[model samples]
Target: MDDTGLISRLGDVVGEANVLVAADAVAGYLVDWRGRYRGTALCVVRPATAAAVSAVVRLCAQAGVAMVPQGGNTSLCGAATPAAEGRSVVISLARLNRVRAIDAANNTITVEAGCLLQRVQEAAAAAGRLFPLSLAAEGSCQIGGNLSTNAGGVQVLRYGTARELTLGLEVVMPDGELWDGLRALRKDNTGYDLKQLFIGAEGTLGIITAAVLRLFPWPRAKATAWLAIAAPETALRALIALQDRFGPALTACELVSGVALGLVRKHIPGPHPTLVDSPWHLLVELSAGGDEASLREELASFLASMIDDRRVADAVLAQSGEQARRLWTLRESIGEAQRIEGPSIKHDVSLPISRLPEFIERADRALVEAFPGIRMVTFGHIGDGNLHYNQSRPTAGDQTLFLAAQPQVNRVVHDLVDELGGSISAEHGIGQLKRAELLRYRTPLEIGMMRAVKEALDPRGLMNPGKVL
Candidate 1:
């Protein structure tokens, strides 16, 4: 279809007021949040309802124009960004923000695609439940994007990833047919779980309209502690011991590297007074239904035993809830600190919990040996074996030269991740950034199967083309 004709059709679907055509107005939606990729779109369309989204998708599909689905545009990868070639229209789901229902009895809350992550959290909290998907970008990220990426956060040790937290989804297929499979059933083994297809598709297969998310009972008591352990291995041991002692009460077990902490101190401003300098620090939290004193006592006893056994060198328990939030603030600040330091090669890979120690040791040694004077900032949910293994620019070198080595660095890191029966892309889905790497790492059969599914669903390849498979 001609450019003029295409714009006219899209305007009809979402109205002219909601269609953005000015270059300056569409600039922010063109590039990704991390500036890793920059793309072009003919226009940006904001549809407030699923019906409008379907109409927009159908119009674009008929015009042979690709459609890029965007939520909060908080992707670390370029998943939400459109292609550089101006043959697509970015369908921003920001206008579909609404809380449809909250069923406390079923422990579920249904929300539209545009609802902010923090907003959903607040809504759940107000309803006396916890959303449990906490992340650094919670304040800005959208629930649809979170589900699309299947985001894993600090609480994944207990609550699981966004995929697991989601019970059902309402998506518009590539052809613009609305699939209303939003039933909050705990057991449905009737056929293939269709919702799983779009959950982590990164908007390639379809646009997610809304989701039925699982909720948990709000914790009456909470406890947090910072432990200085000998190594990641010790942190792992302590993690198991805490689980054995507290069971489901253990909410979060985050591993922090001394290098990661130092980055925060050097790059980020202000005093991180609650932070304890150690080779490795573990931020542990317990969400319980009993008294706070009992929760603290349980965690303190576990840490005391670890300290006596030499697994921990030092430890500090949060005296109050405010102190606990302070401890968490430091962990959340690591990403921002690194961002301020400047751009670096970031990898969100995951390995088996048992093999995490070896993966870290080998990957660290390999990267350092291959590239001298490289800085390794490692920290993540060690309990779930997902590490945000990132490499900082050399202190004394050309920044572009170091950044240019991304391919080699990814080869080294991703090869090891594949060798250890681990995933090259963990919480962060394979958007455009890792699309080529995904083809190389994933087997041809697997790739063919993914392609088949994509072809079957998006026959014309109009839904987020140039993305995952």
Candidate 2:
């Protein structure tokens, strides 16, 4: 149970070189991606295989030491960071990076949890397939964390969230037992889908070692456009029309506020005059198994009709692939721009598509009334009803003062989210940042059932404590 013995046992399971005991080496594991949370860990452990991870977990469980499973440490909600108690070990799965198999015939990619999402996408592309789970952090975030958080990105409008993309999972349970459920089958209705339990559990019930993910045919032809809409209501109507015209070809339909675009233009360097000034913008993309020329023509015709009908004010279609990438870069840079600007209160919530307009209107009004002259930077996967609704300090105000109002700001935003039957934590998991909020929003019975399940799986609570339930 002593620290020395614990480190030695962990070293024996993995290797001495993989066990980071010094403070300087473990510093990165302590802090989160957003620099919002910093926690202490007894040590950082690198396990390169499922067997090694299982051994590490068994040792930690037997010693009554908690284990925080981490991958890339790219969590938005501090889900992968350790607590400040300095009693837990941070198990980094980055060493387990590997593509176990790529079955183009079965349309699945079996990969270790440590594989970066972009790498997986690349691997799929090399094999003439598409892995659609993508976000701004795709370059660094790993598949394990993506599944743990059930991440939703712009593509969720077509491909669904991480949970939907997952076909099977290989997990190391809390007690250090390996549950090799990595079956790539599409249908096996034997009983309860146990993998679902750990998908969005935030590593509390177990650690995901690998996964079998679904893949789609590579998009043959694509079209991207930026539409200047009147408001969120207009964006919704545009989405319906686009879907009706293109059906599943409509791959992504994102809503970006003018303020969000302004931040990108101000903070990030890029070409100017590419898009017309507008109150709200919708970045829409269509992917189809047809000729590129035909797809572009169809999208152009659709835009022209929308403009004539007054559904869209003005629109510009990407003339080339590079132009499309530039348009996407604008949508993806909002988060980084916000960070560069200053400290802000960020909320990742989802509402029914029908209620999104009302939710935005009410939340905006209430926030401005509560904190006069507050700036709202709202944008996200509108087609999927998930919004990254964030607030920044007024131009003349201090960030310290604005940050101090986070708790109050959260109440105003979350209360309205509840009334609208939306989730407080949509794509983001209930990590340390939202643990209390989860308790407040979830019903007593719901919380009790979650606790019961947690107790049944991790009775000692040695798994990632202080997260989720």
Off by over 4 Å in 1: none
lDDT of 2 by residue, 1-469 (tens): 8878999999999989999989889999999988998998888999999999999999998888999999989888889988877589999999889999999999999999999999999999999999999899899999999999998888998999999999899999998999999999999899999999999998999999999999999999999999999899999999999999999999999999999999999999978447888989999999988899899999999999999999999998998999899999999999999999987889999999999999999999998998998999999999999999999999999889999999999999999999999999989888999989999999999999999999999999989999997
Q: Estimate each model's TM-score.
A: 0.98, 0.98
Q: Can you write out model 1's per-residue Cα lDDT over 205-295, one digit (the tens) per residue?
A: 9999999999999999999999888788888888888889889888899999998989888877666655556889899899988899987
Candidate 1, clashing residue pairs?
A: none
Candidate 1 at residue 117, lDDT?
Answer: 92
In order, what lDDT does every prediction score?
0.90, 0.93
Error of 2 at 119 (Å): 0.6
